[model samples]
Target chain A: GAGVSQSPRYKVAKRGQDVALRCDPISGHVSLFWYQQALGQGPEFLTYFQNEAQLDKSGLPSDRFFAERPEGSVSTLKIQRTQQEDSAVYLCASSFDRSSYEQYFGPGTRLTVT
Target chain B: AQSVTQLDSHVSVSEGTPVLLRCNYSSSYSPSLFWYVQHPNKGLQLLLKYTSAATLVKGINGFEAEFKKSETSFHLTKPSAHMSDAAEYFCVVRGPYSGGYNKLIFGAGTRLAVHP
Candidate 1:
């Protein structure tokens, strides 16, 4: 009955620092997605995974953004050389199947780069 | 490419009055539309979805939206506004994903303010 959960609800990082955001998808969920929400703006897609496979990373803003889900249940989004532009709310969502449109979201981790 | 547009950036309504949040979408194929609500410092919650089922879809908290293919609109509406209804509302469209998965494209969102 638990929903998707993310760790470190808030994170502050210095410029050029590397930060990692974690997401724990709902148990048995086959699809996981990450999104970025800038202030006063809508969320933008970042990446997606099906099981342990990183199927889509086209939405990732830059090469510095890397994501992995080795075990297929917990996924992490790592940003290398963090920049001020990287500041935003990182959101994680999971769905029952790949095609299912209904996604449950986590509270999100707000990252601030200074 | 599929995209969604939330016409209004903000809407204010008095308690017990009607509420309307307009949304229009563009897609190459049949679209799956959804409405999500976000409270401050909280996760997004699903209000309702239109997956090519009924034209009018009802969601949680007495909210509903009518899917109109001709107008390319899926506008959310409620007969009465409650104090708790104040929040940010998003209209999302699912992009065509050939890999058995679809990407969600969200509108800028509409901020709803309820007044007493």
Candidate 2:
């Protein structure tokens, strides 16, 4: 019984560079979510996916942020032109379905933009 | 817009002492409230949830929370604090339903320190 998993536990990037973060949701989990946690702040919702569709992206900070889940099991969050403000921990979560309230989280990827 | 407030930014207690982390929330409708804990460099773990079914909710590791609609609060408590309980705690509320799903709104978080 594996939980949600994310790649690139830590990443350092130069300003204006592009970065992609990956998330592997638990098996059979049809609902996935992404969140961003800034230093000393609570995590904020970034986007959500149900199956292969991107249902919500209202919390995405800017046009540079894009996410995709082509096969529904794995998702990726891509940020173009990395900026200092983009430095934060990116978390991924998954649940059995859209109605499930409990969400299992991944360890998260910490992105540092210099 | 729904929101949550963790009253204390930090709480320090001696081991075996009672622990209390206060939270307040505002929402347009009856909300789903939750408590999550995050250890250093670890993923967030659910402590408990109150979905309007019962006012008092019990969760893992001897944690519990009481939801009081009159006070607009969902405060987490433990009879006795443990050294392992030293970590960050978050109060959360489910956002407005949309497109068959809802997102989670998190409070700024309360860091607990347990000293023996």
Query: Local error of candidate 1 at A100, Å?
Result: 1.0
Error of 1 at B66 (Å): 0.3
- List model 2 lDDT by residue over B1-116, tens digit each: 89999999999999999999999999989999999999998999999999989899999999999999999999999999999999999999999989988789999999999999
Give the poorly placed runs of model 1, Cα more than 4 Å off: none
lDDT of 1 by residue, A1-114 (tens): 899999889999999999999999999999999999999899999999999999999999999999999999999999999999999999999999998889999999999999
Q: Which runs of model 2 end up more than 4 angstroms from their true locations?
A: none
* Tens-place lDDT digits, model 2, residues A35-93: 99999999999999999999999999999999999999999999999999999999999
Q: lDDT per model, in order?
A: 0.96, 0.96
DockQ of 1: 0.88
lDDT per residue for candidate 1 within B1-116, as digits (tens), equals 89999999999999999999999999998989999999998999999999999999999999999999999999999999999999999999988875779878999999999999
TM-score of chain B of each: 0.98, 0.98
Worst 10 residues of 2 chain A by lDDT: A95-104
